[model samples]
Target: MSSAFEVRGGNRLQGEIVPQGAKNEALQIISAVMLTPEKVTISNIPDIVDVNLLIELLGDAGVRINRVSRDVCEFQADNIDLDYLQGPEFKKKSGRLRGSVMIAGPLLARFGKAFIPKPGGDKIGRRRLDTHIIGFERLGAKFIYDSDDNFFRLETNGLKGTYMLLDEPSVTGTANILMAAVMAEGTTTIYNAACEPYLQQLCRMLTRMGAKIQGIGSNMLIIEGVKYLGGCEHTMLPDMIEIGSFIGLAAMTQSEITIKNAGVEHLGIIPEKFRQLGINLEIRGNDIYIPSQETYEIQTFLDGSILTVSDHPWPGFTPDLLSIVLVVATQAKGSVMIHQKMFESRLFFVDKLIDMGAQIVLCDPHRAVVIGLGRQHALRGITMSSPDIRAGVSLLIAALSAEGKSTIQNIDQIDRGYQYIDERLRKLGADIRRV
Candidate 1:
């Protein structure tokens, strides 16, 4: 059974909210616990659905898990049951999470074999495993795909490190290949790798575990093989996506919000993008303070042209926050174009905004023109279903800023990425309840 959120909009929310742990970082770091048999202590673990599901999968794989607190845990994979990977339970559980695919690298590196069924997650666009598979193949792992059961099997007598250039700067692919190459024979040089902050955190954690990796925050990485890895403690950075969402939320609702401990150092180009949208935000140390505004104007280019916001690799704007940006622009003073370069279906949620009286023109599957209403007319909420994680939160923000009452169905999508969002919003004076 699924649940929904019944939100009474038009409230000016005001409060200080702390962001949860980085979900993307937690997924990669938790899966990395399988690389060593020693105890690995990780703090700032987010209690969201997707992350908790990954922890459950790890526990089911026979990892010794100790929950120190709501946001901390210790993991030991000394007694993993290799046979469990062949069971139906593993297939059913692992197939539900896209993060399950990440374990293949650790398993293959440490145990010489890995098995995984087709993983599932948000259906935003075409997410291919070619980078991961090709990287593994370059490192001397034999790959076999079973189309009937939708399973992938990989094994290696011994992995020998080699040079490989990724076709794309895939974050998960880089993390996966990095974990595998750290334990292989000889040196592995990976060019065109992802250099996101989360990936850099992974490299630092691996370095603490005695892995020799160069180029922590660059597109190229060189890793020297090691015979074994030891355990180390790691702390997750505050989720930048959530910070971006809260910034957007503050703008959309015209509320005063302070996001505490936002990890602003890692939030490259995010604050500037929001500033470009004409939202007023102040960076007080690590905290982001968004002031309430009656109306904010969108900036035009110096050439007197419309502004365009698009997603790119790290140091560029994140694709995850583009949905929030699109939603926030609905009521600004000027027009802006949202170019969703990564995912084709991400812009489809604008129709829900359009239904709420937002002046938006969906030019194509990947582009939309949002003409700011400038609060000339308030949006009228209606019932809608969330399409994906980012889209779900974007819709929730839209509903919170709309007039009258609104119902958001498929809230599980929101829960997968956000922890107790309704409860947290309530602290900021939002009249939202789970139904």
Candidate 2:
């Protein structure tokens, strides 16, 4: 596949861009489709690599999939081929995506048996499967790990709901347990649950499909098991991470861009976090209007200490956007310490930015100190490889604001999440070409 983004920097991009459907939400929502045999119609699904791969994996598992439109599709899992899941081919196919682990939840909940390969995704850091495994075990599922094949077999005669306080509010883990608990024998209370908008959207979609869930936007969730789940239509929210990236892009490139249908209410601490960087944002009736910034300054704390941005669970800054935040800070007028608590390797990409003439100190695996250039120093763009989804876009943003042409290879990493990112950026008058 063609996979390099050639970017011409120093363009004052202008126009309105609508964020694509959320990638994380699509993964969780599509996995939940397997819980019911009825047709589940979903709208606003992003045409990204990972989502498409998950859809293809579902099709290979004998789930009926229909493409209603570019942004709409229907999925039905009435005829899952269980034997195929046990074969070597299943492991080879399902191992391609981390989202594939989510299928185990519905399969175990519905059929009482599931075989899943060890999932594959960006190697940003060690993304623990303990949360998923222990959560399933807590829901009364018997799990077997085959170290030889690196596969997992989960079986249960019946799932019995119980209290499960997650070690961390893992978004995918919460979605998996929520799917399993919805059809269990009794009520399940999940504390310290991931309450991100993605999980909230998943819970809302499950509710529309006749599942009982309380605490839509809190760390604690109460789910009462139900026997049957019917089909329902669910629409994914706009990709908030992409929106945050776009906001960073506009600020770094001094562009005037308006983000449409931004779902402003659901952006928990995102806009506030951006405001902390002194990047001005105006919300006009569900749209975010970012004017071309001449001088965006970073903020300091109350005691006049330098501000520090860090990632936490939901209601805190999302770790996914910290890369974008780090990129945006490169051009701000002040200094900020970026503490990426979730993923260790995520902050390592700052070396690439430093190579482009940005002042950055790679303090450690999880932290970086960036002293903004204040538009006085123009970054000279160079070739780089995208390390992961977020970092790829972060580099792309840096390239867009830099002084010369930049070539970002391994753009497949970026494609995994962002939908036709080059095309989307071009719509905003960005001179980016996918070569």
Candidate 3:
């Protein structure tokens, strides 16, 4: 792929679009596969850049993998070569995805040591790994920050679990600690754990692998460490973020679209968030039907006041989808305050929306006020560049809804998270092409 892409937009996307598996969940699940020395089959893995890159990293680590189908992968972790996993190739691959941080605890638990490089994801803002480090330390792991190498090397003779409380509900931090705790010598109690569906899936996978874990869907978790883990087959849930993004896209373009196989159980607080922007959705069986509601009016609270949409940790609204929410609010009828507390730079993309004729105010690095266009003014298309993954997709939706042709550059950032977005949108009658 090139360093960037040029997208010609301005088409009303329509038709049914099925989202790929959850990229975030897939990453954590794949990393968890390394906990056992048996074959683990993972179905519904998204064939995006991140998953492909992580699979290549796993292959380099000497884990045997085979593609059973387009979205199904069979993984055997019996032969991970430590020497192959410790070099620059590992760092190069691991640094490309934030989920790479999740491998630290699993590798340490399985091999007694691990060298994890700093992870990379969207340049939205500062994502601290302090919670992860502290959690592992409480589980009897010592970390060595290799200042010269820019890697954090963690070692342990044998993991011993203990009771600990998390300062914040960090998703990846909870995943890392959970992986470590599953194989520790004693019982590990984790309080304030993020009880997202992905965490529940991870716990289920661990249980199938013969590890004892309790408190599956709450802030507290008690894990009885086991001697070893076996392998199992699991299917990933649908990507709720993708579903939400598509809902925003359909609303922005005034298109009737259906999102198939969206896991509603994991979609807590999402429909409510979109409802705040007056984007009505119809649920038919497992699919979400978003009709063209061009006359969108932001629904105020019961107190009859302005509404605010803020991103929090898991189970709360996801910070990853805030950019999409902000974009969706621009087309509604009322004003809203979008609070992005997780990342300092996520709200920076509002400038592009502002340039596209959306009324937005950058209150600070973490907050923005969006005044809806009241469906009177259509956004005029213009040349724009993507800065990050979610922002890039948000721009695409804006461009698709714009009146004229718009070109978006740096779309590779968008491709990192979304799989074949142009082709998929084209299938939905979107006039999008990559150049």
- Which candidate comes out best when scored by TM-score? 1
Per-candidate count of clashing residue pairs (backbone under 3 Å) = 0, 0, 0
Clash-forming residue pairs, model 3:
none
TM-score of every model versus the real structure: 0.99, 0.98, 0.97
Q: After superposition, how far is residue 149 of candidate 1 from its true place, in Å?
A: 1.2
- The TM-score that candidate 1 achieves is 0.99
Which parts of model 3 have CA positions greater than 4 angstroms off? Answer: 1-10
Report the Cα lDDT for residue 390, model 1: 95
**Superposition TM-score, candidate 3 onto the true structure:** 0.97
**What are the lDDT figures for the candidates, one per model?**
0.94, 0.92, 0.86
- What does candidate 2's lDDT look like per residue over 1-435, in tens digits? 657989999999999999999999999999999999999999999999899999999999999999999789999999999998888988998888888998888998899998878767996988888888898899999999999999999999999989988999999989998999999999999999999999999999999999999998999999999999999999999999999999999999999999999999989899999999999999999999999889899999999999999999888899999999999998899999999999879887888898999999888999899999999988888999998999999999999999999999999999999888888788888899988
Tell me model 1's lDDT, rounded to 2 decimals: 0.94
